[model samples]
Target chain A: MKKGRLERFLESDVDNILYWVSIFVVVLTAIIYVAQIWFVNYTGRYDLLECRLKTMTGINCPGCGGTRALKSLFKGDIFSSLYYNAFATYGAIIYILFFVTQTLERITKGKIKGIKFKMVYLWIAIGVLVIQYLLKFIIPGYKI
Target chain B: MDNNFNEEPNYTGEVVGEPKESGKAKASMICGIIGVVLCVIGCFCCIGYAGVPLAIIAIVMAMMSKNETDGELTQQAKIGLICGIAALLVLVLGFVIGFVIGFASAFTGA
Candidate 1:
């Protein structure tokens, strides 16, 4: 039986799927970031992304302040980004560097070394995320 | 009969057991399932970007499972790959829809 297009695509090689999707996701993210910057510049409003949890519970979620952190990071305000969300600020930087190296390695056909993903990376994120979330509760004065 | 049962019946030391799956395949499957769960939660909740890292991890792990062959993947690896892709798609959709709606509303001075 002849396979349909969707079936064929779904059954395609894992590497090819990952490779293409990674590129697409990264590029889409970059475009969205650029558009966000433009929007902020044009509108003079940072109300685009509201913390739904804060609005409902009058408290911060684990990911609270992420949007502001991203905004600051995109604007190159590292200190402010860290103030908003320390882990997010550094995570974005690391992710960008990782992707850049990955692209270079691919383009250069492995001539350039790429950053390898490690389980420690996930562990670090988890630790930082939890600690920061805890700090937000323990120290009311902390900006987090 | 007891001695025959106890003594090795000229048994070659070949271990007769189920083949162990690769570490990468197992990791991929674990990460993929977690990624899907997180991504789904993220889509419905405020933490819409939560599962992006897990999805990437799943993808990387699945890719690493490839042996000498470029395209070949085990069953677990395939599950991981599919789930990772699905998670990514779901995350992107949630984020993009949110941004688009927000952008449209703000642009209309609403």
Candidate 2:
């Protein structure tokens, strides 16, 4: 009798590896989350590379200080990240939500629903990209 | 249009292939192409770090296209995804390692 695909997959050592890898990712994300919270609470500052770099370089990238924004966001400092870059904060939230939902579904062997990539959303993203690039280049006060 | 009553209808053995590819798949291929283009631009531009993540996403999406019924679209997506990932990784690593070294220099005066 031919073994079913599920039975074969379950029997494979790849399943065991995948299980451990997933655990590692979850634990690492959790640890990073905690560290981010601690850092934000202790420092009372959302950024480590903010004005210092901005001062040196006369230009800013659209994603300037986005890493710090991500850390602040993970620390539940929504307002802080928003202050840094509202779009980046929103993007991070969206990315995290999608990642978590899909990861959970995959782990549970649940069917993941397809997200319709709307034209509006794409246009919005493109607009944000252009605006951010312009702010970085044209508006010196908005650097970082 | 001819209407026949009670005559044994001849079955044409010609198998019409799958219906033309869905719009969704075509859109994904477009997105994958865009991702590759953005990643390449990011490599030359200062935003090399962002390229890696975007490229990775593109590669995953392209690979996911394997389940799609369209062969040509799948092939294009795969190529774009691979190129994007490779270029992005090289640029990101270069910058990341450079930053690490720069940071270490701040700690140890040499």
Candidate 3:
């Protein structure tokens, strides 16, 4: 039986499509984050996305200061970034890894190694969120 | 003692087990799991936006991989696809609920 065009495409080009889509997503995210940082730098206002939890409950959520953290990190303020949101540093590292992996996979025609999200990484991320949440309470005058 | 049959084993066109699973299927499954995890975390934290994009990517990858594979591997891809879609749904629902609540509060001047 002869395969249809869609079937042929699914069998042959799907891998390439996945690879390219991943690359596009990572690139787009990086661009957006950079633009957000630029906006914050110029406006001195961190109002990208409002925190619904904070607004409603008058309390800091685990990710309340994430945008500020990213902005501070971009501005070379490591201490301030950590004070704002520790996960920003780890998120930045993950973003860099995603960008490199996707770029390398494309350049090497999928010959280079591909990366997988490990369970350990997820656990570490969750742990960091918890730790940051706890620190927000323990540290005096810790503003979200 | 009649075991003197010396015939060569015919190994031509024999039925083998299912085709070897594609690496893409495995990748799809992993991505889906990660997406679901991120979405769950995002629901509590403030990272729902980040998870939504990842969930979309995972769903796409799973669909592509599902098209390329079959049998047990297809099952794996299906799991990935379901998880990815569920994560996206969770994120979208959260956003909608949050928006409605915020709007109601503002409208009521609460």
Candidate 4:
């Protein structure tokens, strides 16, 4: 007939759903990345969807080489990772940090704190966007 | 019929205030701007994929405004949501049909 602290907290919170959802997505993306790398190595080919996309479209989408970039990073091939998608390696770092922050905040129920690096993050994001676009135009034979 | 029996109860929960309406409105406004920007970009650059999701998100955020307690932003949310939804529908339908027909033709060699 008695309830615990965890149950009481859950009853009071609406944000738990969002928090859990964020964790799920982060975990799922990581799993998918692993599977994709295995498939790529086994087949000696990237995704057929992306291959066809590049052949037909003649220009790369922002997320075109993100998977390859992640794969390369995991394999410790820094130059290959950059070649695949420079922004993506950095993106994975940010994603992991985001996941950790959200998880900590959710578990603490309001006591957890966050860093104040907004301006720096904004500048870095803008820089990456510009660099990605420039590299698309400048770098030859590095097509995504 | 059970609505009469289940009359709405007055607020009696912990007094944690809801998220600010301005924050929600700012989010909706950003989504709308991004949607329009994507649509334009897609049109000019022939990459409609980027714009479709943006438009959808904008519209959903806009529709959420109806439930918002922010009086100042209600109209903005409604308009933005409606426009975004409309744009997304048009673009998605147009692309789907085009792709279907093209694929059919390619397969049939006609």
> What is the CA-based DockQ of model 4?
0.09
What's chain A's TM-score in each predicted model? 0.68, 0.47, 0.61, 0.54
Better of 2 and 3 by TM-score: 3
The list of candidate 3 runs beyond 4 A from truth reads A1-22, A30-48, A101-119, A138-141, B1-21, B37-47, B71-79
Assess every candidate by TM-score: 0.53, 0.47, 0.63, 0.53
lDDT of 3 at A48: 43
TM-score of chain B of each: 0.73, 0.47, 0.73, 0.53
- Candidate rank order under TM-score: 3, 1, 4, 2
| Model 1 per-residue lDDT tens digits across residues B1-110 | 35543334436865545445565665676568657755764654444454677688788878877862366898888988998999999878867876786689799987
Ranking by DockQ: 3, 1, 4, 2
Q: Which portions of model 4 miss their true places by more than 4 Å?
A: A1-48, A75-79, A109-112, A115-127, B1-23, B26-58, B69-94, B97-101, B104-110
- Per-residue C-alpha lDDT of model 2 across residues B1-110, encoded as one tens digit per residue: 66444443446854455444433333334444445434544433333234444455455545655555544445555554666566566666646855776688789973
- As for candidate 2, its clashing pairs are none
Which residue window of length 10 is worst by lDDT in model 1 chain A?
Answer: A9-18
**Residue A119 lDDT, candidate 4, scale 0-100:** 30
Model 4, residue A125: displacement in angstroms? Answer: 3.9
Give the best candidate by TM-score: 3
Per-residue alpha-carbon lDDT of candidate 2 for residues A24-110, written as tens digits (9 for 90 to 100): 434654566567668877988755324333433454545566656777998999887765665567656654554566567666776
- For model 3 the local lDDT of residue B51 reads 61
Model 4 chain A worst lDDT window (10 residues)? A9-18
lDDT of each residue in A1-144, candidate 3, tens digit only: 999975554454334444554566557766776786787789887654456667667888677787788889889998888888886667676656755786787689979865644547656866787798898989899776
